[model samples]
Structures are given as structure tokens and as C-alpha cells.
Target: MGVTKPFPASVPLSSRAYIDRMDAGLTSVAGAQEIISMISSRRIVTKLILGHNELSDNGCIVLFKFLGSAIGRKYQITEISLNSNSIGNRGLLAISDYLQGNTVLKELFLQDNNFSEDPEVFITFIRALNASHLEVLSLTTNRNLSDPFAETFLPILETPHLRELHLSAIGLTPQSGSPLVAYISSPRCRLQTLKCNGNSLGFRAVKSIIRAIERHNFSLLTVELHANHLVGPVSSDNTSEEDGDEETGGPASPDAWKASETQIRRVLFRNSHLKRETEKEAIRLFRYARPLLLCSSKHANAPAPSTSTRCTDCSCSEIPSPNAPEPEPDTPASNRPPVEGIFPFHALPTELQLYTLSFLAPSLSPAQRSRIYNFASSPSTLPRLGLCLPSFSSNSRNTCVLDPASMPFGLNANTMSPGGGCAGGKCAGSKNSVLCHKEKQRGEWLAVVGCSAYDPYREGEGEGVGEAGILPETGGAV
Candidate 1:
């Protein structure tokens, strides 16, 4: 055996030792122990960077346990980086358990893991993380997941301390969408920032969560739902069976449906991803309806007379102009009507409505939304607009930017106002700040919401909707 070196004469305590910084980059998993020893020795070492190591599940468990138990809680180790590790779901689970009492850990990085492969593990981890004082959690670039994904996250929604949650490139499931939906609808979910990019979440799941937070409530300060299969580039004027969803179901909550649609409207309006097919679908539904819902002082009534082609009768001005001439009249137009019978608002199955809305939403201009009254209200004590629509501030990135047509992505940012910081204080000024400005700070928050949506393929992150919601032309109130 080689001669052992003598123990240090004066080892510094984690909380008392002073150091500018510490770089614990390990060449191998075997070196993580050395890192822990070094951290445990330095009583005041505030930051430790042991990321980019190929640590396995076992390695991660060992490191996190030692760090969280001693240096993490005993000495106030605020910053720790353990990214690029092959640590699977088990490693993450172990880390979560260890981090329960570590409050000084203000910044932690553990991205590019294998949690998505077992979504149930990810869901369980998040649910438990809700109870911890975790400010920021990033799980970007997870590859094992892709589509038909869903897992429980209501615990996170219910978490009182957590402010930001990042799950970009995480293949989403329909079942997972419910918690997100409940959180968006819940007034107590102290959710400030949520980012999910490059996943397989379809319009059905997206519509649910987005609807609950329609009209850009102040509670949801920062949101990033980007680079998914649901919204992608296609040939111009694309109209095929693939353009629609796989299936449709009856309405579960008429109020939730309306609420979700309005939220989608707001998102689409702010950043229109519109195309010819999307616009045509919206018009087709109106064509079949014949007359539109009439605006009333107290109660909603069927249309008494045609105002101006009703909601769909207006001319396709590049910008909404109330003064623009009306169409020849939908009544005289040939009756091709929508494929589904009855008006979408009254007859189409809820799931069908969701699909139709996803296809046609690119056409609903937020500028025109100003003309419609708050007729769709939920029984859940939500505002008349269901989710209160923030007043359109011209300077606000959350304001409407609906085009002459609408969005191809089916989402509208009209409701996502650049409101006060975050959905709640737990989000803003903390991890939420990181999410709100993630697009602008990808190099910084490398483990967050995957890459920025501005250009998923970009080197570093670019601005996201919350930071840079600037859209091409077409204006409307928030």
C-alpha cells in the first residue's frame, strides 16, 4: 500500500471557512467522494460545482446523502452543481429525500438525467419536492420520454414554498395534465413559473391547464410551453386528417372547456401561429351555426338579427377594423356547415370542440375579442371571463397580437400578461425570476425548461414568451 498523507493541520468548517468559490469538477464518479470530503472539511464553502461528471445512480445517492446531511444543512452550502450525470430516477429520488432539510441550497443543478423514462418516479419526486423548500428544479434534455405522457404534479401545485418548476423536453402524458390543470385553476397553488418544451403534449392536455389560467391572471407570472409535437411547421395551407387530433370526447365541464378556449385564445392572439387551414376551420364552424350568440344586458340569448356576418361575418382585414365592410352575408352562403352538427358552443362534443378549437384558434383575433362580452363564466367562483383577462397594456408582452387570421399553434398569449413578477411570490424574486428570464439566460439556467422556444436549436437560450412575447404585427388589448 502507498503511504497515506497526513490529515490537514487546519481544516476549515463549511460555515466558517471563507473562499471565493470552489470547482468540484470530477473526472470520474469515484472522485465525488473526494468532493464530499472536501466540502465537509470546508465549513464555509458556499458554492460547489461537481457537475458534468458521469456519476451513476449509486454515485449520486452517496454524494447527495453526504452533502445534504452534513455540508448542506450543517454549513449552509448554497450552490451545488451535479449536472450531466447518468443518475437515473432512483438517484433523483434519493437526492430529494436528502434535500428535505437543506435550506441553504439556493442553487442546485442536476439536469440531463434519466427520470423521464419512469414518469411515475418523476411525478412522485415532484410531489415530494413540493414539501421541500426547493426554489428551482430543472430537468432539461431528458431523452427517454416523448409522447402519451402524464403523471401527478398536484403536490407541486399544492406546494407552498416552491416557486418555479422546470420540465422541458419531458414527454407529457394525458394523466399528468390533470395536476397542471388543477394548479392553474387553483387560487392557492403558489405557482409562479412553469416551463415545458420539446415534449409530446397534445392540444387536449395543453388546453386543460392553459384554460384554468386564461386571460393572463397575475398568479401565473411566467410560462413556457414550447417545441412540442402539437404545434409544428407544416406546408402552407396544410389541410389533412393529420391536421386534427386522434379522437374527440363529450364535454366534461362546459365551463372548463370555455375557460380553456379563452386561455388558448389569449395565447394565440399574443403570438399567432396562424395558417389558411386554421382560419378556414373557424369560419366553417360559424357558417354551420347560421346565427351567432347575441350579446345581452343580463342573459345570453340566440341571435335576433345578423350584426355583421355575426362573429365570423366580418371581413378578413389584415388588422381588425370595426369600420371594415362586412362579408356578403353568411346566410346566403352555401351551407357546407361544419362536419360536426350543431354549433361548437352548443353541440360539438367537448373533445371535438377542443380539436376544432386547436385547429381554428389560429384565426380568432384578440383584437376582435375585445368586442365579445364575458358570457362564458364558470361555476367555480372564477370571474365572469372565468379566468380574469388582464387589461391589455400596449407595452405588456402579454398583450394580444392576433393576426388578421389567428394562430397555427392553437395557443394564444392574449391572457398571459407580463404581469407583476410571477403567479405568486414564491415564484418571483426566486426561481420564477430564473424562468421568467430563462430564454434570456439559458447558459445560466442550463437545467431548465430545456432550451428556449425562440429557437429550440439555438446554442444558448433565447427569449421565451414571458420575456420576449413580441409577435409579428396584429394588435389587440390584453
Candidate 2:
């Protein structure tokens, strides 16, 4: 049968679509085809939910054919749910083939399905997972998968994009524990959620898992161990360490199990705190960086004056005047090429640039940091207010220029105290002291109130206020 036509225009395009249970007679191959066709037509649909439909292998095969097609490639779907659909290896392999070339899909839910019937199918799926962008996967209650399944799935944990995994009640045994612990302990493991509850894991295996979580798996936030063989009471007569090795389907003692649980929780708490702080820092940095990097729409689209060299609302003037000598034809902002005034530093990924700045800012010297701040700040802030005061020493007549950049607390009346630059009260005692030189000359004040300063020539004192400590060439602007 032919695929169904697209939905009518009367229906608004939505980002998410739900077709649960397939009560609309969409449980067969024709139904799958119709669903795929409808979703493909709506380019805005990013999430597709079709769970509990029992669309077995036949329907799944048909669905995947559309997903792997060129028309499917044009769709923006990033999430797909096929849970409890009675899908088997053939259907899963087909999905795997689609994933090999797909980059948009980040979530796939296939819980309570009939998978692992053929081990090679899972092997191929793992290979496809390595190439895919899928981040969250659910395979819960697929009890057919055994220890070998865990061995084969170890590589999926290494997939950087796969963050959350649900493998609960998959018939895993004690043999699968070593491989899981080893993988979790690896520094490259980035899996954040690992749910393996309802498994047959023993005491030693649980202990190993806890130890690995405590030592290496800081990214993991939720590790469901409920309903697993984890804890059991111990007899007071068996006090030796060997008693813990018996592995009677539970921990050697209830106390030991509680201790392990407590330790894991502490580690997870620390990790959670660190993650929150990191996110807060990232947000703070982005707040500061966004205005400097992004061009406002008003400035981005403003037309340039024919006679003027720049726009008043934009930083286009900051670019070399000669580079844009002629006025170009007007175009939409979206179609325009990148503005020359925008720094290439903004081209880096947002997270990477923010992190780089966070690490780099602390290591920079005060002067270097000031220069960076000036660069990032508005053009009006680039001009520092110069303070010129008459020399207070009896021997000199030149003025002292205080560059706020050199001052520890910045240039202000409070920081211009006698103890700052004047040594031995020479400036306070001299007739030429700021207190006595209250005259104004050519829009310049010879002295500032509430401060007795300006003995910039004292040796071993007022070192930075001397002639040699005047504003550097770069800081001499205004």
C-alpha cells in the first residue's frame, strides 16, 4: 500500500508529536509508513513519540526505511521513542544502519523490546552507536541479554555522546560486574546515568561498582541499585575479612553495605556541587561575553551614511577605514557575510571560549587584564581621566600625572593621601603642596581637595609616581 498524504494545513506545526498505543490503526507496516510520511512532511517536528504500539519487526523495518531515506534526512527529528513495540534484532539493525549516517537524533527509547536474539545484531548496533550522536538510550526489561551482552556493550559506555543509559532487568550476572567496573573506572568514561537495577549482581560485584563510582565516575548522578542483591545481615560469629568473600548473593554485612552506600552518596554529592558551580560560572561568563560578541539587530541592520566614515550605533568604524572605502549594496542581515569588526575569538564554540577565558583571566597580570578589559569595554571607557597635580617638592616644578592603571585602588580622592606618594611629610610641609596650590590653569586643577599628594620625586619612596613611572606609551592616550 502507498504512504498516506501529509497532514492538512489546518493543523499547526508542532515541535513534538505523540502517537502512543497507535489507537488510530497505526500498528502495521502501512501505519508506520503513514507516520513516517506525516513526520517527514512537517519539517518542524523534532520529537516523535510512538511507544506501546506493538509495531514489531515488520513495522519497524518500514519505519527505518523512511528514516534512512533522503527525505527523512531533511527532517529535524532529534528524538524517537519505540519502547514496548516488540521490535527484534532485524528492526534494531535497521535502526542501527540509519544511525550510522544520522547526526541529529540524540535520544532513542527502546525499552521492553525483544532484542539480543542474535548477538551479532547488537555488535553491529554498537559499531553504529560509536558513529551516531545518540545521547540517551533505554533498553530496560530486555531480559534475553546476558553477561555477553554486557561485554559487548562495554564500548557504548565509551561513546562520548551517550550520557544516560537504562539497562535495568536485562539478566546481567556477576560475570558482567568486572567489565562494568573496569569501564566505569576508566578516565574516558562520561556516562552520567547508569540504571542496572533488578540484576543478579552479587556482594563483591556491588562493592566493586561502588568503589569505581567513588574513585572515577564523578559524572554519574543516578545509579539505581534498588531490587539488586546488595545487602544482607551477617552473623556475629563470622568476623573475619574472608567472610565477606563468600558472595552469598549479598554483602558480607549490613554495616559494610551501608558504608558503601554512604561513601557513594558523598561522592555523588560532591560531584553534584561541582557541576552546579561550574554551570553558574559558565553562565556568569556568558553574561559578560554575550554583549561584547553579539551584534544587536538594530546595529547589525543600520545603514551606513554616504559621507560619514562609520555608523554611530555600531563598531564598524573600529575596522580600518580604508578596508570599507565604498558603500556596499544593502542586504538582509541574515544574508550578509560576517562583519569585519567581529573578533575571530567569537568563532570558537561558546563553552570552549567561556572555559578558555575563565582559565586565562586569573593567570594574567593586572596591567594585561586591564588592557583586555579596556578592549572588551565600550569605546568611551577606553579614555582614562588624567589627574595632573603640581609637584610638591621644593626642588621640582613639573606636574605629576596619575595613571589610574598604576594605582592599586584606582584614582580617587581617598587614594591620594599624603602617605601614598609624599615621604617624610615633605609635600605636606612644602609651600607648593596640593593644599596650598589651589589655583586652576587652562581647564586643569593644580590640586585636589581632601588630599595632600604630589612628591613623586622622593627616592626609595613614591617610586611609581616618579618621572620614570609616568603612564606608558599605550596608556598616554587622553
Candidate 3:
């Protein structure tokens, strides 16, 4: 009796099918072409995973024709994984044709193929990426990939939509690393994850990469630099020192940097075996480093704490006179002075600070008002405008107060009482020579009325208060 064969299920020609490993056991070109013919006739398969098959140029051409054809476009085939299949220049060239017109495909994995011999093939592939909507591309283990094709890949690397790039084990050196650093540094690049492990990128290249990350204000989440010849984790040290305060909201020192590197989940350097057990140690440090880089609630314009402007206990809040000496740098954390005030004004939100200032401004006397304005006009107050009330004029007849009754603009200097120092360029007709300091300070007499008079973000030193003596009467405000 003859054995009966199992019948194949009927699949609709109009329906989209998902095929995976259809050619795993089929090594013949004819067999691969037969599958492509069935796909073309049926107009099915939204995903095709045909890796590890000996599909050379002829088989690839057959697949590309169907994928690029008008009928193939209707099926919405969005993924194609053809890895380790002996694909070469001819096969890639054929696929490039499909990529030019195809907008539906989102991912392409052509890793471990043989397209590195001719540089033009990679160039052609780069051009194809420009026209395609492919978001993720992996060309791993193409060992011949080097500097000759670096220029060709830069545009693709900087592609705004290409969020993930995998080029591991591609024999890349500083030649390729230089251009890659440029690409990563560019604000145009939207890449969030970069895998360039197992390359020969040296320590200098890693330094360049770190500088780019900071200089460009990178938003990358993960970067793998494992199994490279990188001399050390020097990038972390440098970046930590440069951006430590900003990242950790703390001091700019090595400890803070190490703390930041451990806290922030931004970089990855697991297998950079530079010193003996160094990579392991770095990994261990980051693993145990408590995450302190929490999201801050301060307003965007609020000034961050720095050596010059640290006000831990508000001791630095003594408003400087127009002639006050330059402030000393903040002391070390160990030698920090004890707190004196019940209210931590430095810890308050900028809006709250402004609100408090507004309440305090109305109650101050005319003399006190002038002193506050003098303090607010200093360089330190520019960055913290939310606490400033107004920019008073340098006019000698100015009363500095918002009250209309004592307005000095229309009244003569001799009309006011002596205590008001309106005489001798002093307040309320008073001849208080001690309170009336010289007005030779630069940017000291700005007449603009509102907080928006000068932008703090713009560059300019509005005359520093170096070695100038503070008036005893206005010392508290200054």
C-alpha cells in the first residue's frame, strides 16, 4: 500500500502572511526562487526572516524584485532579516533598488554579509538608507568596514529617524571613530543607543566621544564600547569633572563625578579591559553608587549652586554695595559654616522667592528701597531675576521708591527734609556724606524699569565689584 501525504492548508493570495526561516534547510538558489515566486503570486508575508541560508546574488535578486514590485508594496512587508547568508555586492545592489522606493519597511538586518570588499556597495547602501524609512540598521561583523566608507555612513548615522545603530566588530579605528564622534556630537542625530563594541577605537577616540557627548548635550541613553583598545575610562573622569555640578547638583570633583557616573544611566563601558580588573571595578562602582541625580523642581531660569554663588545658609545674601569687594569662593564642604536662619531661602522655588521679595519691597523705606535696587543691579542678581524688583535710574533726583507723594522727578532737591537726603546728592535733603557713595561703578545706574531690562543669559560682565569698599550704612543690602 502507498503511504499518504499530508495536504497543505489553503492560504489566501490577498491575505498577508508571516514567514520565518522558510529557507533554513533549503540551500539551492532554485528553492529560494520558488519561495519568492510563491510570495509574489500570493502577495503575502508582512515579515520575512531568511537568515543562515546560502542565498547569493541570484536568489537575492529574485527576492528584491518581488519586494520592490508594485504588487509587493501592497502587502506591507515591513521587516527583512537576511543575516549570515553569503550576500555580497550584487545582492546588496539589488536590495538597494527596493529600498529606494520602499517606505513601509522599518528594519533591516544584513549583518555578517560580504559587502565590504567594494566600498561603493556600502556607499550605495548609505544612499538607500537616505531614501528609506528604516529606523534600525545592523551591519555587525563586516570586518572590512573602515575609514574609506566613513564619509558614506555619516549621513546615515546622523539621520534623525535612525534611533539605534549596531556596527560592532566592524574593524573600526579612529579613522571611522572621528567621523562617528562628529555624528554623535551633532544635534541632528536622534540616535538613542549606539553599539560600536569590539572595534580598535583607542583612548583618544573615547575622549573625543565623551567631549562630543557633553559639548553637543547628547540625549543618548546607552553606549557600548566593550572589547576595544581604549586606554582607560578617561572619558568618565573628564566628563564627570566638567559636568559634575550640573549632573549631580553638587560639587565639580572626582568623587562627585564618580557618583554621577554611577547615578545617571547614560553610559556603558562594561568590557573595556584597560587595567587589570579595571572594567570590572568600574562596573562594580557604578553598581553600588547610589543614584542621587533626581529630577529637580527649580525653575528653568533659577541659577544653580556654584563656587561663586553658593548660599547654603544665605550668609552670602548680604547685598554688596556698588563698591563692595569681590566675593570669596565657597569653602570646602568640610569647612562649611553652620546655618543661622530658620528659613532656607536658597532652597525656595524661584517663584516663591519673587513672591517673598514683592511682599518685602512694599514695606521698605525710601533709603532701603534704593539700597535694594543697588544690590539687585549687581552681576550676581542678573541670573536670579525672579528675586529682583526693578532697575532704578541713576538720576540724582531719583527717590527709588514707587510712592508718588515723595517722587523726586518733579520736586526740587532743596524742597525735601534733611533726613530724606535730597541735598548733596543724598536722601531726603539730608547731607549724609557716608551714605552717598560715589556712582562711578559701571552698569550701576541702569534706568530700565522692569526685570526684563537685561537678559542674564547673554554674555557681558557688568563691571565686577573688585576691591571696592562697601558703604557701612548699605552693607546689609550690598
Report the lDDT tens digits of candidate 2 across residue range 300-403.
44453233233232223233324444324364334446668885554555446544665533322233222233333322222232232323432122323333
The better-scoring model by TM-score among 1 and 3 is 3
Candidate closer to the true structure by lDDT (higher is better), 1 or 2: 2
Candidate 3 local lDDT, 133-231, one digit each (tens)? 677888888776665666567845434346578888888775666677778755456565778888866544544576675445234556776655633
- lDDT for each candidate structure: 0.46, 0.57, 0.52
Model 1 error, position 303 (Å): 67
TM values, all candidates: 0.43, 0.55, 0.47
What total of clashing residue pairs does each candidate reach?
39, 0, 18
For model 1, what is the C-alpha lDDT against the true structure? 0.46
Residue pairs with clashing backbones, model 2: none
**C-alpha lDDT of residue 207 in model 2:** 69
The order by descending lDDT is 2, 3, 1
- Stretch of 10 with least lDDT, candidate 1: 375-384
In candidate 2, position 147 carries an lDDT of: 78
